[model samples]
Structure formats: C-alpha cells, structure tokens
Target: MTATERPDVRPANPHFSSGPCAKRPGWTVKNLENALVGRSHRSKPGKARLVEAIEKTRSVLGVPADYRIGIVPASDTGAVEMALWSMLGARGVDMLAWESFGEGWVTDVVKQLKLKDARILKAPYGELPNLADVNFDNDVVFTWNGTTSGVRVPNGNWIADDRKGLTICDATSAAFAQDLAWPKLDVVTFSWQKVLGGEAAHGVLILSPRAVERLESYTPAWPMPKIFRMTKGGKLNEGIFKGETINTPSMICVEDYLDALNWADSIGGLKSLIGRADANTAVIAEWVGRTPWADFLAKELDTRSNTSVCLKIVDERVTALSEEDQVAFAKKIADLLDKEGVANDIAGYRDAPAGLRIWAGATVETTDMRALMPWLDWAFAEAIASLKAAA
Candidate 1:
C-alpha cells in the first residue's frame, strides 16, 4: 500500500523519536482529571497516589519481592547519580562504556566522582565491551541498552550469581520494552518519558536488598548531596522507598505515569509490550533486506536492538557524493518526511554520522510503520536525485 493510502497513517504513530517516545495508545489529558492539583504532595491523597504508582510499577515490571521502588528527581540521570554517589566509594568500580550514555557515566566517574581505582572497559559504538572480562567483584555500572547506537546486551548471564559488587544499571530505554532479569541487577533506574511515554521530570529507582544493604552500611568518601543521600546515620531510610520523596513532585505527572502503568497492565504487561516492539522492528528489518542503500547500524544481528532501530545508507551512488553532501542529502529526506507528517523526528543522533534512527518502542504501532516505510524510500530517492542534479 502507498504511504498516503494506509488508513492507520498517523503523523503521531510512526513518530519514532528516541526519547519522550510516542505516547501510549489512547493516551489523553482527560484521563488525568483527579491529580490533586491544588494539594501538596505531602498531603495524604497525593502520597497515596505516589505509593500506588511505585507499587503498581513493581508488580507490572515483575520486580522481585525484595526490591524497593522509589520515585526520584531529574528523571533517569538523577536516579543513577543517587546510586553512584551513595554507594560507589565503598568498593572498587568497573565502568563499562559502549555508547553515548555509557561514556557519560565514565565521565561522571573520572571527572565528577574522581574515583582513583576504577577500571573502564571501553568499546566503539554498536559493539559491547567484553562482558566476561568485567570483574564482578567491583561495583559495576552499565546501560542495559545503548539507545543511540541501537545495540543491547544479549542477556544478563555474565553477571556472577554471588558477586560482591552491586550492579547499577541505567535502563531508561529498556524498561517496559524488554525483559529485565531482576536477580542479576541490584539497582535499576528509568525515566517516565521512555517506554511508558509519560511526561518527563521524574525517575524510578528499583533497589534490590543487597543495594539497600550497601546504602545502609557504606557511605561514599565524597560528601553526599541532599538528593543523593539514601541513608542517614548508617541506617536505610525505608520511608523514602514507600512514598516520601526527597522533594516535591508534579502530581499531574504522577497521575499521567500511573495511567501509563495501567495501560501497560491492560495490554497483558511486559510480554505483550515486548511483542509490539519486536513486531514494529520486524517491519523495518524487512525493509532493510530489500533496500540496497540501507543497513543496520548494529554490527551483529544478535546484538541488534528491538526498540531503537538505527539504519545507515550504504548505497555507492549516495556514497559517490562528498561526505558532507551525502549527509546533507540524508538530512533533506528526513526533513521531507517530517514536513509531510509521514514520520516525525527520525534523524540519527548528533554524535553519530548521517543515518536514520527509528524508535520501535511498544507505543509505536506496527501497522503504521509498515505504511511509513515506503514513504521513506520515496523520499530518499527523490532527495538523492535532487542532490545529484545540483552537483
């Protein structure tokens, strides 16, 4: 079917932006009418809603019974920094870097925390550092999925069953779209704007029992920031995980997030959500198979990401143009898609070279993606021909 002929053609459905991804199916402002707008977050009703959001997320995500879930400030970055500042100094650290976010953490470790004995296992984008080479005995930090490069760890089997270190994971992009092995992770952090498609500004922190023990017993050598302090006087502040946030939160945003969680439940939870992501990505995978100019940015099929599917144009005809010209041509096609409203925000990440990055998260409908693919081919052909004529 032509892209214009498809009935499911929504400018919103085939959005495919990396973060603040497309909203949940049937999401609307009317769904959040009773968010206690005028009341304080410290009020009884507001606190109750906060607690419900945490508990429901735990149930929906299949977090272990022993884990504690909390809402934190600054979204995913805040949640991760809280764990790092509160727990890292007590043990040696092994920082893993495979993409932009991982490299951001490495910068935080060296420049921000100034940890003297940390070891970094680094790899180029689209590849993972050797998981087996990591020393689990040291506190470990990693991104479960590299959203920018569209690569993800195949599984969590490399984590030792009885390692002494705490595994801190930034799972902002992987939360609802992939199965998380809670037993293999100690501290996990994610933002509402990711898979859930809720508004940004808040983060969720899931702490395994071991992570709590570390927080209660060991303090970092550096002074604690007010937001990062999870314990006081060497004792865990259990209330923080219950509903008592470190600071105020947007009740409206909380209500919206709860709505997202409820929608997640309605769709048969994570398994079904994963199925949607897989199906949406499969549409792109099939397109890649037939298009001569297109290839996956991910090096290996097994490591290829189902959520953020990035593509590189490899056609020699396009490559015949100067490098700068090729990139400009690619940008022009992306702009055309955006202008026609056939797709929105599918440009590659800034750090990466010219290409397209499409988010196939659960919120995206596969039927819409199927309709959108042909339009991409048409736009690319038109843009390349124009560039050649100009040259």
Candidate 2:
C-alpha cells in the first residue's frame, strides 16, 4: 500500500487506549452533573453513590453473593498490595508473572516484602507462566490478563476447586470483560480505568468467603499502612465493603464509574459487555490472519487476550534490523497513526516487547476496530518504506 492510499472509512472515535480507556460511547461531563462533588464521601448522598457503584459492579460481574466487594484507594495496584501485605506471610506463596504489571508484583513480593517462602514462576513478555506447576497448597498470585503482553490465562480450569490456600488475582484488565471463576478465586482486584472506561486512581477489591476468613484469622508481622488495612480488631471491616472506604475518594470519579455501570446495564450487562470485547478482538484477529507482517504476541490462540491485544511486527524488512532499530521502526508506525488521527496511545508499554498494543474492550465499537485495520496496514507499509529510505 502506498502512503497516499488512505482508507476511505475512519474510526469515529480514535480512543483505543488500554487504561483510562475509551469512555461510554456518548459520555459527557453533564452525565455526572449531580456528582455530589461539594459533599463529603462520608455523607449519605455521596456514600449512596459509592454503594451504587459497588452493587452495580457486583450485579454486572455475577460475583458470588457471599463475596465481599469494596472501593479502595490507589487503584488496582493499591488493592493488590493491600492483600499481599495482609495475607501473604501466613503461608508459603507462589507468584506468577508474564508481563509488566505481573512482574511489578513479583518485584514487590521478592525484593520489598523479602518473604522467605516464595516461589516465582516467570515467562517472557508474550507468553504465560506454566500454570500446571502451581502449588495449590500455597497461596497463588497471578494476573487474569497481562495487559502489556496481551496474553491471558485461558480460563480458571487450571485452578483447583478445593485448594487449601487462596487465589489473589489482579484482574485490572479483565473484570467486566472476562468470566472470572469466583469459587476458585479468593481475592480479586481491578481498577475502574480499564474495561469500564471510567476514571482512574480508584480500585475495586472483591473477596470471597474464604478470603474474608483469612482476614479474620491471620495477621502479618509487618507494619501495614492505613490505606491497605481491611480489618478491624480481629474481624473484617464490614463497613468498607458497604461503601465505607478506608480513605477519602473522588466523588466525581465515583459518579463516572456509576455512569459507565449504567451504560453496561443498558447494553445487557456482563454477557453483552463480554460479547462486545470479543467482537472487537475478532476484528483484529481477522485482520492479523491475512496481514503478513503482523501476528499476535501471544503464541497460543487460546491465551490470546481479547482486551489488550499486543501485536508483533514480523515483516522481514523490519525484523532484519537490530532490536533497537526494530523498536524505532515500530514507533514510527505508531506515531504516523497517531498523527493521522487513526488511533491514540496505541504504543506497546515500555516494559513490553517491541510491538503495538491496542485496546479492544467493551467500550470500543466493532465498527471502529474494523476501520482501524486498514489504517494499521497502511501505517506498517508506510513506516517500512520510510525506514528503508533512511537506511
């Protein structure tokens, strides 16, 4: 394709960002007009909004009735650290990492916490760690989807139903779009910025009956920060799960989340949301099937992520270059697309393998994804030609 052979159709919205993702299709600040911004989050109206967000999340995700869900500070990272700090020292632990965020957790557990009885399971940027080797007798921590790698756990089939220890999952990229195995999972954390396409700096923590029991039973020797505390005396902090956050929350962000939740409901809730994401991915999959230079970073079809779809450039001209040159070439393609108003913030993460990572969550329209395909083809060809000219 030549540089001038631009596709006639364009994505109506060029917001394929993975985090703080594309907002609800028709979102407007006016939707959050009654945000209770001036009121304290502890006030009845503000608390009611927070509770509504939690209850709506519970309903949309089909979380177990007995599970406890809470709004927490510092987004998904905060919620995950809170769980790790509070519950890990009780027993031996297994940590799995395949991508940037997962690796961050690994760093925290190994370097910062300095736990004695910890096993690390690792994989490269585009693959998943071996799940079959995981020890269910010990607590297990993993991400439901590696946002940077675009590789996700195929399903919860690998998890043991009767495991003695708990499963702590960072499902920041999977919550509303993926089917979480609630019974097998003990603790789950996700941010509002991903699939819901809402505000950032806020996280939701979901815990099962087993997890709540752990909170009641175990106590870490380390000094737990106030933001990470989820227990009072010897029992669970029931109020936190009931909209009593451990710290102050942004009421406007809470309202934004509520608006996204209502949008999910109007679109048929969880099943429909998952379907939309699946369809968006299917579009890219179809495009990749015929595109010679591009392929999914995830080697296994089953593990291919339907949300953050990481793609590698395999065109010989590009791959023939050194790794540094390959990165620069990929950046050119991404930059050209951005300049053309074709897509925004679609670059692969700093820690991820050199490639393009596009967001394919529920908020993204299928038509837009289809439109973006031709542009991707154009960008690759154009970038390669320019790279050769420079060479």
- The candidate that achieves the highest lDDT relative to the unseen native structure: 2
Summarize candidate 2's per-residue lDDT along 145-207 as a digit string, tens digits. 999999999999999998999999999999999999888899999998999999999989999
- Give the top-scoring candidate (TM-score): 2
Q: Please estimate how well model 1 matches the true structure, expressed as its whole-model Cα lDDT.
A: 0.87
Q: How far is candidate 2 from the true structure (C-alpha RMSD, Å)?
A: 1.0
Structural similarity to truth (TM-score) of each candidate: 0.95, 0.98
- The true-versus-predicted C-alpha distance at residue 158 of model 1, in Å, is 1.2
- Candidate 1 per-residue lDDT, tens place, 186-273, comes to 9999998988888889999999999999988886778888998888778888878889999999999999999989999999999998
Candidate 1: misplaced stretches above 4 Å? 1-14, 320-326
Cα misplacement distance, residue 335 of candidate 2 (Å): 0.6
